[model samples]
Target: MPEPTARVEPDEIRRWLSERAAYYLERPVEELDPGAPLAELGLDSVYALTLCGDVEDRYGLVLEPSAAWDHPTLDALTAHLLAALERG
Candidate 1:
């Protein structure tokens, strides 16, 4: 048997976040980053819920409610999201 391949990549995760950020901020995706603070981008609880919904719908992964508070950064959230995907 062959080893399984990973479908996700760092750039893809970055792009996903970038696209979502653009949708949330009404700006270009290039302006977003893993280090960008959600508050600095004007993302509130409503936006967070929307983002979590998007992640779950798009990636087929469910994020716990606490995930928003636990993984505030894009990189951290991406890591958690990828881990959840891998688990499933």
Candidate 2:
């Protein structure tokens, strides 16, 4: 019998976050924890600000500067992005 495959999100927001976080933290995406706080991953002010810009550019939305803090986890950030994107 063949093994089952896992379902994936089409937007790939989670994948984007994982890759971005990994790049920022100097690690591989596979080593990142989706539910882990980005701050705990060594995300500093510069990283946070750049990430906010990245999100805004990617979604074409106006977001607050503190958005990274508001959505600390990859899951939380992705959920918020999905909701915002759906609204537009």
Best by TM-score: 2
What lDDT score goes with residue 63 in model 1?
Answer: 76
Cα lDDT tens digits for candidate 2, 1-88: 1112322253487898788888888998888888889888788879888888887676575678788889988888888877776666
lDDT of each: 0.72, 0.77
Provide the lowest-lDDT 10-residue window in model 2: 1-10
Candidate 2, superposed: residue stretches over 4 Å from native: 1-11
Give the Å error, residue 70, model 1: 1.3
39-77: candidate 1 lDDT, tens digit per residue: 676767787888888887777666776676688877778
Worst lDDT 10-window in candidate 1? 1-10
Task: State how far residue 16 of model 1 sits from its true place (Å).
Answer: 0.7
